[model samples]
Target: MGATRSHRIPRRAAHPALAAAIAAAALALTTACDPVGGLNSAAVAVTTDQVATAALQHQHVDIKWLTCTAHLDNGPRATPSAGSATKDVADVTCDGETKDGRPITVRGTVTQEVEGRCVKGDLTAKVADRTVFRASVLGDCTAPAPTTTRVTPAPGGHPTVTVTVTVTQSFQGK
Candidate 1:
């Protein structure tokens, strides 16, 4: 009988540029999809703007600039509760000056909603050591119900099926 020989195929290495590009794309996707951090920043900005607006309305003399800051009370690791995903909270402070050079200040705490997008909280604005405005703001984070889709092959043609599910989240506020 004749001797039998085996031959093996060689594997090729990935190109360095291609590999780098893939890594960069992955990193970008990871950062962009960070729900918690993104939500926190957005919530803070919105809350600050709302507070400033309320203060302006109460003062009715804002002719200068206003700045606000928020300090997270629960930090990043805080988890939402089982019944309600209300966990993230921040203490906010704002300062500005009116056209007449009067000092304006706002203070409050903001709470993140279950959906992780909207917020609800109460804020108080003071002008020159006098309380001028106080109110509570609510953000609507209602999401639609989940939807499912199924695809089945024709009878006796092939025993194959495909299923898909979709979920969505949204935020609304004044």
Candidate 2:
């Protein structure tokens, strides 16, 4: 019987610099794909506007010329409970006029989830001195983002003012 010989293939170790570069690339890809982690104050502001408008429309209010602004509350003072994920809370305020020429206002705080769609919050809508709508929205709490129109004055000495308006379609929901 002839002798059988086995040939072993040696494995090469990855260089330290290559490993570090791979790690950095992985981290960058992860951060870029993570919607929750990439949410900034400007994005939160837009989300807040959508949420507030949805809340108002849910109450059958025909909102016009709505202007919304948001402030993020993820500062050092914000602390989540143990075992709970850190949440980004945005304080939102919207002001506009109703179809009937009455002033409408929405005040609330909203939180957007990681799915890039789910938004939950507590909102209150008031027409003049009467509170028309108030609730803790669980899901489907987003509307179309508002649009801004910049009106530039003519070559005269007039000033330029930027205006943002959100006009929601009339909703017939009780």
Candidate 3:
């Protein structure tokens, strides 16, 4: 019989690290796909949609549109249903920081639409004569059509590639 020596696995195995990295990457991809839940390279959940949701809710619509046409600062805005009333676009603002310590702010209304009380199938979320929300604005107010927008955060020190979200929204009573 030959003498046998005890063997033990290494405390830090490359396999485990690799697995964790892969899992993190996979999660990042998933969150990145959504308007919110962005990883921001450092697992930072920061974005326009997230900010808007925090500031407002039950008033979100997948509002998507193009802005600053010449500069192409495309934005997002959701379509509201007919006879639906939008909660007044809150003249609210929020402050937050990215994963990299970069401060960001969302200066807009929380986009959304809801249907319930339809007095002659007409509703509006106008402020000071500004058509921020309206029932049947799209001509069809039977179904709720979510919207989207694109927003890119300011620079984060290094040359980091920015992901522009096409829209930001939050809905209530639906």
Q: For model 3, how does the per-residue alpha-carbon lDDT over 110-160 read when each residue is reduced to its tens digit?
A: 222122101112323322233444432222236442232333444443222
Per model, state how many residue pairs clash.
Answer: 0, 0, 30
Model 2 clash pairs are none
Candidate 1's C-alpha runs over 4 A off are 1-34, 37-39, 75-86, 113-119, 138-174
If both were scored by lDDT, which would come out higher, candidate 2 or candidate 3? Answer: 2
Candidates sorted on lDDT, descending: 2, 1, 3
Candidate 2 structure quality by residue, lDDT tens digits, 1-174: 001111111123234454334433322322222233533333333334444555666777665546655555764433355544566676766677766779877788666532222345677778888998776663353633223322333454322112232122233459
Q: Write the per-residue lDDT of candidate 1 for residues 1-174, one digit (tens) a residue.
A: 001111111123234454334433322322222244423432353335433544455456453545555555655453455444445566767676665678877778766422322345777777788888675653334643112222332455421111111122233337
Q: C-alpha displacement of 12 in model 2, angstroms?
A: 71
lDDT comparing candidate 2 with the true structure = 0.47
How many backbone clashes are present in model 2? Answer: 0
Who wins the TM-score comparison?
Answer: 2
TM-score per candidate, chains pooled: 0.46, 0.49, 0.19
RMSD of 3: 23.7
Candidate 2: stretches off by over 4 Å: 1-39, 77-85, 113-118, 138-174
Off by over 4 Å in 3: 1-45, 53-57, 60-62, 65-105, 108-157, 165-174
Local distance difference test, per candidate? Answer: 0.44, 0.47, 0.26
Cα deviation of 115, candidate 1, in Å: 11
The worst-scoring run of ten residues by lDDT in candidate 2 lies at 1-10
